[model samples]
Target: MPESPGLDELRVLAHPVRLRILSLLTGAAMSAAEAARELGETQANVSYHLRRLHEAGLLHVVEEVRIRGGLAKRYRHDPESGSRFMSTDPREGQLLLATMAEELKRRSEFRVQGKGGLTADAEMWVDRETWAKALAHAHELSELLHRAAKPPRTRGTIPVSTTVAMFEMRRP
Candidate 1:
C-alpha cells in the first residue's frame, strides 16, 4: 500500500477532471468508456487521465472484461490506501485546492436541498485539544462516507457530496 502520493502524483491529481474521476472510482470500479459517459467527457480524454492516475499509483485495476472483442480494464480507488494529500509546497497545495474548488462548483450545480446535509466553513483560532478532536472527528466522518459509498444511481442509494479541508494554519 502507498502511504502518500508523491509530487508526480500530486501533479496528476491537480486536474479537475482527474479529481472527479477519482471521486467516481471511489464508489465502484469503472472502465474508461463508462467513466466518460458518466462524466460527459470523451472516452479518449478519460482514458488518458485514467492512465496518468494509474501510473501515479492513485488508481488500481480491479478487473478486466471482454467488450466488443477487446479487453476493457476496470479501475477503482481505495480510500483506505493512505493516499491522502500532504505537501510542503505551497504551489502544489494551491493547485490541489483550486482543482477541488472547481469540482465543488460543478457539484453545486446539481445540489438538491431539503434532504438534510452539512455545510461548514471555519478559519478561526482554536485550542490544541479542540483542534485534535476536530481532526479525529473529521477523519471519522470521511471514513464513514467512503465506506458507505455505492455505485452511481445504485438502488436505495442517494447521491451525495462531501468535501472537507481541515488543517492548522500558521500564525501570520
Candidate 2:
C-alpha cells in the first residue's frame, strides 16, 4: 500500500481532468491516446494530465505495448496512494471539497438521465456505536462493488454510478 499523498499532491489530484483521467484508469490500464479518445479530449491535453498524475505518484506505467513498432505506455491507477479526499493544507482541502461536489452533481445528473438508476437521500439518528457500524457497512459495500468492477476479469458490465452519504441532519 502507498502512503497518503501530501498536500501538494492532493491539490494536483483535484484538477477535474486529472480526476477524470484517474477514474478512467481505475480497474484498468490505458494509454494516453485511448484515454483521450474515451473522454473526447485532445491527446495532448490528456497526456498533460497523465504526466501530472504520474509525477504526483497517483499512477504507474504497468506495461509498454509496441504498436506499429512504437511503444505505447500503459498506465494504471495507483491505489496505494491512499485517499485523495482530504489534505492538510486548507487550500487543497477547499479544492478537494469543490471537486467532490462537482463530481457528485455530474454523476447524479448522468445517472438520472438514464432509465432505472438510483438516487436516494435519507436522514437517520443513531448512537455513536450504531453510526460507526453503519459507516463500516458502507465501506464494505464500496469494496464489494469495486472488486466486482475490476477489469481484465469481470465480463458483461454496465457502468454504474453510486453516491452514498449518511450524516446527521442539522437543524436550520
Number of the top TM-score candidate: 1
Q: What is the lDDT of candidate 2?
A: 0.73
Give one digit per residue, the lDDT tens place, for model 1 in 1-172: 3255566668887898998888899999999999999999999999999999888768999999999999999999887652466776777787788888888999999889887887889889989999999999989999998888888999999888888878778799
- CA lDDT of each candidate? 0.86, 0.73
Q: In candidate 2, what are the lDDT values of residues 57-156, reduced to their tens digit?
A: 7889999999889998988886445354433455666677688667777766556464786556667567889888988898787777755555533577
| TM of each candidate vs. truth | 0.92, 0.76
Clashes per model (N, Cα, C within 3 A): 0, 1
Score residue 102 of candidate 2 by CA lDDT. 79
**CA lDDT, candidate 2, residue 93:** 61
